[model samples]
Target: MSANPSPGSPRVALVTGTSSGIGAAVVKTLCDLGHQVLAVDFNPAGETVAEASGAAFFQADLTDAEACRAAVGDAVKRFGHVDILVNNAGIQHVESIESFPEAKWRQIIDLMLTAPFLLTQAAWPYMREGQWGRIINIASVHAQVASPGKAAYISAKHGLIGLTKTAALEGGEHGITANALCPAYVRTPLVDNQIADQARMHGMGEQEVIEKVMLKNAAVKRLIDPSEVASLVAYLASDQAGAVTGSSWNIDLGWTAQ
Candidate 1:
């Protein structure tokens, strides 16, 4: 027997940032595995992707607290209950601290850090009422370490881990597990957008940036596929992983191994 809800009782999964990249892969993976996923993203394209994946779509600007709450409310309204909450929605703004915009800093923190906290707060009742839950934050390896020119992104990611720990501590006796996945340089649009910035900063070709800058510390020396991260999300969201909480699971090709 599977160590999860029975085949007929699929978990109602709510995934943010499902328009593309790891979030999209996660939505597709959960749906393909027979879970009912509610895909949430501000992007209209997310609705199309969610529809194509046979998951319900809820469009919302996650930076807004009302929108965050609505995302959870809509999931509960549609699926009757939310069993898995995946905080994968995020944006990247790369610039030196001296040049970073205040608005951008607040924007990234609101979306990446504050939004997850809000969503978790909104979904707490459902998870608590049912006495079963899984909360997965799609944090980056930046959560553990730092690099230059990403002040807001790095700070928010680091804050997210702390939020994850607190959520885990509170939910431990309530049958809820909260954990974060820290992945490095996945082949996503987010990373694709940063290549040029990294290249200019390092005075190298884009390919050189990837080879020397991005993959330099990683033992595997290759970008991770979104599906690889999705697989870990699947494991973390499973009943078998009941004991895995308040942990930062890294899929960074051994970047942090050193």
Candidate 2:
């Protein structure tokens, strides 16, 4: 072990959406790597996942601006300083732009786009002090390509990419690198619900929706695994990835290769 802490050393990581799916996998992966992880999610059920993964849980509605800052503060209090941040909490609503509810659109933007910005701003000072940090925003393939429905999710993710680039530029001198991960449909509760919603909206079976609608543009014929995405997150959070920032790394299984 080294006397001084560095990016390669275990660091404090604050991850959002720790209840299930990609967020849960990220918490587990980071904790297994010996990082002190503070798992934040709106669901109280996440406490169990955190305990099982050897992470501390912070329950908060990140759509609330104050809650975003509080999550960073909680991480600092628990682990002394935050060295990594994973903004992965989100939900999807499948509806045409004209038919989508106004309130729901605002809610999605608040949670997906605004919360990440607030959390990043809150964590900036600590990382600047340490001269090292990683901010990974869990964007989707929709960040690059759009679909018929899912106007709100697509919009938020697109905006998140812009945020990631701007943060990366601003944090360059301070050694705080920011990047976005764009993955295709991962096998998550959120994507499962999205499949169901898409089927209902398109008047098709769920399997048909998955095959024809979801994988229509892809060369690969399967949904991505949460662990696969988590593996990438591990690399981005490592000292080796210090030079990789301000870019959206795609994990889509040949979805956009065409």
Candidate 3:
């Protein structure tokens, strides 16, 4: 707790992509930490997570700039201000560069990279006024390394890291911190879908896909839990983390270490 009463008070956080997995876990974790949360996602499951956690819910397509702006404005309107923002809304398309559809590449980049920029820009005034803010981007190990296929996802994630760094620099002077979490493979709905798609692509079983594809590069032999990543998000949003900004913290279990 800080000398400023509002600094230690229960703050408002807006977490995008709360339909399931990492997003849902982050919403629950922030709520457990006593923050009023606005959980946003295009998926209907976001409503369920919000209800369970006592957080408000909003459905918005992040690829739409108007929708993204409205989501941030609505969070501010409902909560008086947004103290933190978790930019976790993302989608993956596994395809080689030669085979990847141009439209799909643009869509992935728009959601993962462009949307974070818009949300952060929209939220800057409120954060600057309060002299306190946290922005966490959920990037992936692909941001650091590459694998077969997944050209669009990797490119978008790499761009996200750049956005995270630039925003961190600009926000540092305003008591605002921005960072990215690059986790290898988390046991999320996103990974589950990847398992199925990889199985089909590699002619392997789903179990084989997990062992051979997802965990093959990690020193830790298990998929990282969504809750584990959520815990890190909460820590970064805490007052104690004021000094941590403009860094990509890897939760990749040594995937990038090798």
Model 2: per-residue lDDT, tens digit, 132-222?
Answer: 9899999999999999888999999999999999999999999989999999989999999988899999999999999999888888989
The predictions' CA RMSDs to the true structure, in order, are 2.9, 2.1, 2.3
Candidate 1: 10-residue stretch with minimal lDDT: 1-10
Per-model TM values vs. the true structure: 0.96, 0.97, 0.96
Clash count for each candidate, listed in order shown: 0, 0, 0
Best by TM-score: 2
In model 3, which regions exceed 4 Å deviation? Answer: 1-5
What tens digits encode model 1's per-residue C-alpha lDDT throughout 53-165?
Answer: 88999999999999999888888877787889999999988789999999999999999999999999998888877778899999999999999999999999999999999
- Please report the candidate that would top lDDT against the real structure: 2
Please identify model 1 stretches exceeding 4 Å from their true place: 1-8
User: What is the TM-score of candidate 3?
Assistant: 0.96
Q: Summing lDDT over every window of 10 consecutive residues in candidate 3, give the lowest-scoring window.
A: 1-10
Query: Global CA lDDT of candidate 2, please?
Result: 0.93
- How much lDDT does candidate 3 score? 0.90
Residue 17 local lDDT, model 1? 95
Give the lDDT ranking, best first: 2, 1, 3
Q: What residue runs in model 2 are displaced by over 4 Å at the alpha carbon?
A: 1-4
Each prediction's whole-model lDDT (CA): 0.92, 0.93, 0.90
